[model samples]
Target chain A: MQYENPKIPEGINVTKVHPLKTFAILVSGLLVMLLVGAWLLGFGGGYLASKIPYSQEQRIADSYEGDAGLEQTELLRYLQALADKLSQQMNLEDGMDITIHYVDEGVDNAFATIGGHIFLYRGLLEKLPHENALAMLVAHEIAHVKHRDPIVSIGRGAAISVGMKLLLGDASPSLLGNAGLLTQMRFGRDMETKADQAGLVAVNTIYGGVTGALALFEILDGIEDNGLVKSPEFLSTHPASENRLDELREIANRNGWSMDNTPVPFPEFFNRSLLLR
Target chain B: MIFQILLILVLLILGYFVGSHLEKKHYQSIIKREEMLRDIPAVASKILPPGSENFNQVLVMGNVTISVDYFKRFLAALHNFFGGRVTSYESLLDRARREAILRMKEEAAVLKATLVLNIKYETASIYKGGGKAIGSVEVLAYGTAMIPKASIDAV
Candidate 1:
């Protein structure tokens, strides 16, 4: 009850005095810290984050290392050949390298890792009915590489990476968790869309390139509608935007690339390859 | 009364120290997300030739912040000199990291990079040990916001 005495009229205003005043002061300080902290963490972090370099080749190499499997090596070779042909057609610089890996397992998936690495799932390769579609796929990925889309995506990642390193002092193991993977995936999606546009343009420069984009979309649409596999990594990596696909078609049409009757025969190479075996 | 006052002061000091110590965790998660971003490839922006205006809108995510309410609970226990749940901090930490990432992308948009890649974060203590008397917690986040060289050059 003696503490209550301080609140009485005769007593000095303790609430206006030391301890309570200290509390108010502390609270004010906390608010200022929050405001400043938000700015530093948000805009300041973003500003500084844009400066880091996001290398394409290095990221592809790291992805390969992270999931190094024997099956992917062959796929990588096949993709490399495709990239070379597309490069030649697009008149890409001679020094540009395209590497492709074919994984053995049948998962309808393909991912164009930044740099020149293209991973094609066995299931996805099995599904393609024409070389045009395959060309479209490769062309799109190459576009990402040419346009430096991967580098931009990775730069965003680099900003986050630098931030984490500073906070954890290079020792925290939390980077191995699902949260880590999602952050990478989220940023990767933007690059996928950019690559699609770029890929279309590169292919369209040649006569039959536009068909590739359309055919690829048709294949993807069927897969999504059927709900065959639960979560295909390719679909997960590059989210299919209906609007985006329509835009691609519109772009192709605008360029006078039409759906002509000259059907691209399914390559006999598909039958010759013992991929299912 | 004197002993009680001494006891209360001691408890408050202890609580302040513990609260600040626990605050370090949220900071750690924010940093971890940055590291993950760095591991990925980053590309430069390549704006479509006709539509360059979209490139001007930059979306910046503020520093990943755990809820003040969540942090308030942690601090409350400090005032009471009683420890509560530690796992309660995880969600807040996660929320902050996610927000930071989203903000990074927005910033990239404004910067006109096709991909904002290779990001990392640095954390600083907003309030350290000396501020124990008036229990407060604060952390500063900073990271690189990268856009592809191609896109940046294109613009």
Candidate 2:
């Protein structure tokens, strides 16, 4: 038996390869590369794109040059004077004229364009539960103008804009269909945050503190429970809502601004507009 | 009474459609391509070959501006709706940009330069209304209207 077993050569051992481990390593490496690539692309694109200069002052001056289609109606004149007064108090650059138009539709949206063009959506106008809130929104948008946020936004959006145009063409509704909605989702959230901060500063300079800003946020928060498509627009654009509110409170505290201690002239604006209507 | 309520609803719906239609019509008339292009400077006319200007550097400015009243603004707020084609706004911006470029081109022409370098742009928001919707979007587009500096003499 010994002799028979004799020449049993020592068995050569082969370790079994674990397929899962190999796959995990490969997948992990791939994920790491993807993260690195995305970071590189986003920041790299931003830097390179920013270097392609775009001017803000020139655009504003040009915008004001054309026919500003509003007749000097009493209302128009009043609004213009009010805006000018505010601008002067705020020390906005000279040669910038503020224009106002009245729309009958309903929606809450306000925006500022280059060259001192401000649009107040009918819906937004109607929702001014308080005048200060309205002032806040206006101040915020104005701040954006002051800080040249629009120009910067345009620049930041340029890359995405090109890609979007290539993919979705002009933001035309018919061409947009469902796809355009998806494209809208692709906007950078960070830009909105920057606008919020800048807008706060602008409003603070004008209104004395973050009260107006907070009021706007409060209004937005109150409306969030409402089921509307655009209700989330502000929130979605400006993220970390709680944090922003806290920051606003801090800003108010530092600036000696009141948070709900006194009477703001809401009725005056409301009653005045009512009489005009 | 039921019939009356239904009738009121129908009228409201109809009014909405009619109002939207009227708005669209107003925008169409106000944002005429011809008028917008007219804003372009003569300098642009000289440098931009007829067709080239149409596709590029052609600007349009709107003839009308509207503001969403406070009540309307509240409605917009519920929907968070802010802007539209604002075709008029777009046209105005487009024209302004073209005009600026034209001016720059004219300057270049005087300098006998073909290319205008170092283009820049800017925008500002003017607020109106006690507390309501936006009035208009004033857009400005400015870019260096380039031609070789030597080409300036040809003009």
TM-score of chain B of each: 0.40, 0.33
Tell me chain A's TM-score in each of the predictions.
0.64, 0.60
lDDT tens digits, residues A90-193, model 2? 55655555555554446555666554566666566666665556666666556555555444444444444455455435643343233332133232466556
Error of 2 at A45 (Å): 5.7
Docking class of 2: incorrect
> Model 2 off-target regions past 4 Å?
A1-103, A114-116, A161-194, A197-213, A228-235, A240-242, A260-277, B1-155
- Residue A230 accuracy (lDDT) in model 2: 41
Among these predicted structures, which one has the highest TM-score?
Answer: 1
**TM-score of each candidate structure, all chains considered together:** 0.47, 0.43
At residue A257, candidate 2 shows an lDDT of 70
Segments of candidate 1 deviating more than 4 angstroms:
A1-79, A168-190, A207-209, A227-239, A274-276, B1-155
Candidates' lDDT values, in order?
A: 0.54, 0.48
Task: Summarize candidate 2's per-residue lDDT along B1-155 as a digit string, tens digits.
Answer: 58977875675455445544654564454345324333223332234443332231222221212333332222333233333222223333443443444444445444443333334544444566655335443334344443342343445
iRMS per model in Å: 24.3, 39.8
